[model samples]
Target: MLKMKSTCERCRAALTLSEQAYICSYECTFCPDCTEALSQRCPNCQGDLVLRPPRTRSPTEAPSLGFKAKLEDFLYRA
Candidate 1:
């Protein structure tokens, strides 16, 4: 789950969970506005910046339960 991280890594602007942001391999985060203004290179990893998935409350509040359910759902389907 996403923590209380609410700032862009570059501009340090506030970023809500619903905001479009990019995250590097190392999870270095930046807002889309900042990323678009600059090249789509991760400042930390220098790798491609990927869109971060929205974090759900269950991931943070009930990590084990959510993880187990997701894993089981995938495993049994196969």
Candidate 2:
């Protein structure tokens, strides 16, 4: 799964799930401003930065806690 990072790596700007962002193959995330500044290239890997797909899911929906949460719940119950 895409980590869907919440901030721009360069400027530390907040990036919402539905907002326009950019990423490279290595998932180096950036805001539109920074992306333009860098000429759509990933500073870390020197790869092309492309538009990240916006998440279509509603923001109000709760995020899953994944495997660690399940394991913790089971341990607590036991």
Candidate 3:
């Protein structure tokens, strides 16, 4: 899973999951200002930095059958 890093590696700017950010293959994360300053290249890996996809919903907010429901289903199956 892609780790949603919380700050820019270069400038230490706060990065929210829904905000614009950039990352490289190694998952070096940066905010937009730092990304532009670095010319969209990851300094650590010298890899091309691409725009990180903004997350619409947090993992906790995702729809799921509750734990009780899951356990009941499993017990029934067993």
Candidate 4:
């Protein structure tokens, strides 16, 4: 499963579970703004950026979207 990182690793921008995110093959995550600033490339590996899957909203889903709550409770935890 893809880790729904709570923030953009580059600029520390908040990213919600349902928000669109981009990731390289290496799973280097970034927000669309940072991705554009980097010329739509992954800084770590220069790989193509692709859409990260939106977090499932089902409450019973395994790996529940609890991370979102934690992220909100501590926006700058990372």
Per-residue lDDT for 28-74 in model 1, tens only?
Answer: 88889878865888877788877887754434465456778889889
Each candidate structure's TM-score, on Cα atoms with residue i matched to residue i, is 0.64, 0.73, 0.78, 0.68
Q: For residues 1-78, could you state the per-residue lDDT of candidate 4 as single tens digits?
A: 666778998999998889999998888889999988998888888899888988856334655257776886687675
User: Of 1 and 2, which scores higher on lDDT?
Assistant: 2
lDDT of each: 0.76, 0.92, 0.92, 0.83
Give candidate 3's error at residue 17 in angstroms.
0.9
Q: Candidate 4: which pairs clash? A: none
> Which 10 residues in a row give candidate 3 its minimum summed lDDT?
56-65
Kindly state the number of residue pairs that clash in model 2: 0
Residue 35 local lDDT, model 3? 90
Q: Give the local distance difference test score of model 2.
A: 0.92
Ranking by TM-score: 3, 2, 4, 1
Q: How far is candidate 4 from the true structure (C-alpha RMSD, Å)?
A: 10.2
Clashes of each: 0, 0, 0, 0
Model 2, residue 24: C-alpha shift (Å): 0.2
Candidate 4 residues lying further than 4 Å off, grouped into runs, are 58-78
Worst 10 residues of 4 by lDDT: 56-65
Q: Is candidate 3 or candidate 4 better by lDDT?
A: 3
Clashing pairs in 3: none
- Which tens-of-lDDT digit does each residue in 19-66 have in candidate 2? 999999999999999999999989999999999999977544656488
